[model samples]
Target: MSKNPDTATQSSSGVPPLNPADQKRRDAASTLGNASQSKSSPEGVKEGGELPKGWEWKTIPDLVTDDGVFIDGDWVESKDQDPNGDVRLIQLADVGDGVYRNRSDRFMTKAKAHALHCTLLKDGDVLIARMPDPLGRACIFPGDKRLSVTVVDVAIVRSGNGEFDHRWLACFVNAHPFRSAISGLQAGSTRKRISRGNLATIPLPVPPLPEQRRIVAEIEKQFTRLEAGVAALQRVQANLKRYRAAVLKAACEGRLVPTEAELPRRSGVPPLGSAKKRQDAASTFETGEALLARILTERRQNWLARRSHGEGGKARGQYKEPAAPDTTNLPTIPNGWTWANGEQLFSWSSGAGLTQQDIQEGNYPVYGGNGVTGYHNAFVAEIPTLIIGRVGALCGNVYLTDGPAWITDNAIYAIQTPSCVAMRFIRLAFTRAELNKRAAGSGQPFVNQRMLNETVIPLPPLAEQTRIVAEVERRLSVVEELESVVSANLQRATRLRNSILQKAFTGGLR
Candidate 1:
């Protein structure tokens, strides 16, 4: 038996093409019938499986109109652009995942655009990027006021008939299932990409026109709420950072806790220059100036002792005392507090170099510019100390070690803390000093021993240093707790966004 001519011309899928009016009625009927039959279908619909009733799986080419077009963009190098060009060039950066971001500023003359035969973008045209961050991510091109062309590797899809909503299609492309399918088909070992042919072959879930509109509306409504919550969370994060800086600023300015000048009689300590008279006094509170004097005396004694013991026999020259800090530009401190250079409070030493080959899995943490980089069996500084990042971008960062550690050459360690000084208080002071401002190198910023020793710090009285450290810690602890909560909520918001997209695609939202 021979087939009829009409039947022979029809597509093998057995569905004849319908006019716009007839297609609309058929789609509505199919959607209503499916909704009634599949009310209890599984929510999770796997790709290549039976779709929810009324939803049909269509390839990219199947969804397009008879006159629809698909093409890749032009290949224009940076040197090809004319200074006074009429047509704007749209790069991948101009397209966000499911959103249009007009960041492309490159342009070429209209004559060139016509010669290149670029696909001129129009309103509601779907653009898909071939490369990753996320391969196959797509967005709808919003119409431009002027003529525009996209770069190569970007796929452009245009429908002659207004059969599909661009926003709905964009959302589907950005959702998880479509991305997963495209990811499997991506090529390249380093920078992965999906060819235009592969992209056209990927299956698309086609819901009825009315259902697509509903899904898009609900998704936008939920996204609006999610974005507001994310904005508020970000603001709280920024405020927390400012608050931390304020706490450190207050601590270093001697305003965090009461000073001996404000409460001299609280500990029965005599004022400065009366140490001889108060020798019998059992008070431990000492003015910062008094403590500085004692530290300098001890340093001289230790140097002399080393010299006599021949520990410095190899020295070539006499030691020159560091010049006193020029504190004329420094802020005025409290009465019992004094301004002193870091050299007078702690002995600074550069760390030794230890390569990756030298490091081994062991008990000691090998410190670097940022933090612990590796482990080693050897120890350099045995006592608790402050580590200052000395090289690269992390220069001037400060960290207090809990115990023995091996500090790498990329950092400088404060080895000896004077008897009257609190290490924690000095660390806090450094945090407020913004020492990175003094970094030297133009290419890679650096802090050397000289810069560390010459840095001026506001020295508080011994009793007040302890109190300030305690108060700063107490306040910061609260900030840390609040930050933890904020971070958790931010993570939750991301999960919720993903969940909404999943439900919207799976018919769960309906």
Candidate 2:
């Protein structure tokens, strides 16, 4: 009789002899059954409860053949690895929850493997990740043609027995009850890990060989359906993103709602497409050019008052005109609209520096590059102001503060805006600008006050601004509601996946 090729690598004694201390720990874990539960599980399923005839509670070691292998993976280190070597090194990342991820790419020489006493891997071997993301998750390794070995963070079990299916065992390890049990036996504080001793001792519910195959098949069949549904949900999510971008683009371009010029024409005023029509229209509606003029006058008056009170700034010399926008390459706006730079709209300044330690318990929200990162005791900006994310990945995001808030140094805000200017309109324009793309640095990109000031945007009259904001909000509210529905379904799918796994192991799958 020939020995199975899968078991050929193992010694006749099964797992290698453990040291006295390890043996003692293994014996304790095996007999006491750890937290995998003694008679019943947290899910209220009794140990081997009403298991069909021939089903039994068995430790991992008991399922192996006389020539099978049950052992911890090799303790391979980074320094021991070689890029151009013959043997592949499987890592923790390659172990997925009941699946082989094959994510790691590392190698070592054959001679190096022998020197380190590393065990070679074989197909159908169950590999368990001893450390978390959900520790003790196991998968059946579908071996590679090239020789392979895993790091010590993985444990290998090759059942070379015709009595049990490794695939079924992998599923059992991933089942909620078994994972919950392994949680109690895990060690280490900073990074949790389950020792091989504790891992080998967990009591698992094993069905008859034929039934094991049936259960594994059923689990796969159900999972395939769930995966298909999830893929559809993901596609919907992608579509929602494109729709949102389209809405913003249309809103910014005066296409989402009737343009201010068109509105004036609808009322008895002549269309402002031509300069003569614009002059002839004696419309009460303020053109963007007229609004801009009024804003600048008000801004100058405010500055003069502040200067007279010695409050504007220490370097208050004769005020110079705000810089005009460079519109040579910019898009043309509607007749009643005008192109203006941020400098013409508001005085921009960075927020004050605030660290985590400085944040105190209070009702005031601390707005940072990501908006309302934390809470603070004092507010630096009052309600109805625009905040621009100025640093890192969130750079260029626009936030409209709802209440008094503390703006962190990681953001930029309009320190002063003319009362006639609609802050909401400016926020919408900034968001549509996609400022984050203009961030300059190769690492930790940021947008400065100067960059903001130079950026050009299409501006409508204040009344039109209010109308645009209302229309955009109405459309976005509908989008948000659909997004909420999609989000809830995604979460429900996850719960359903868990429920399927829970039911499969508890004999409910039949």
Against the reference, the lDDT scores of all candidates come to 0.76, 0.79
User: Model 1 clash pairs?
Assistant: none
Clashes of each: 0, 0
Ten residues in sequence with the least summed lDDT for candidate 2: 1-10
Estimate TM-scores for all models: 0.78, 0.79
Which sections of candidate 2 miss by over 4 Å?
Answer: 1-52, 64-94, 102-120, 132-136, 142-148, 186-191, 266-284, 296-302, 312-315, 318-322, 348-360, 373-376, 390-395, 439-451
Candidate 1 residue-wise lDDT, 1-510, digit = tens? 111112222344222333355443234223222322233322234432355678866655566665665667888888768768988888888888877888878899988887777677888888989988678888998888888888888877776664777788888888876676676557799899876655554556678888888999999999999999999999999999999999998888888887777675676655755253234324545677777777777766666766777775422256545466788889878887777887876778889898878897899989988878888998899988999999999899999888889999999998766655788998989877787889999999999988888888888877788899999999999999999999999999988987888778777775
Q: Give a tens-digit lDDT track for model 2, residues 1-510.
A: 122222223334232233356554444334324333234332345444454555566667667776677778888888999999999999989999878999988999999999998899999889989998979999999989899999988888887764888888898888776776677667787999887766655667676888889999998999899989999988988998888889888877888878777876677665433222225435646778877777788878888888988885732998777888878888767778888888887788899999988899899999999888888889999856889999999899999988799999999998887788777888888888999999989878999988988988888877788888898889889988988988999999988988887777767787
Cα lDDT for residue 436, model 1? 88
Name the Cα RMSD for model 1.
8.8
lDDT of 2 at 463: 76
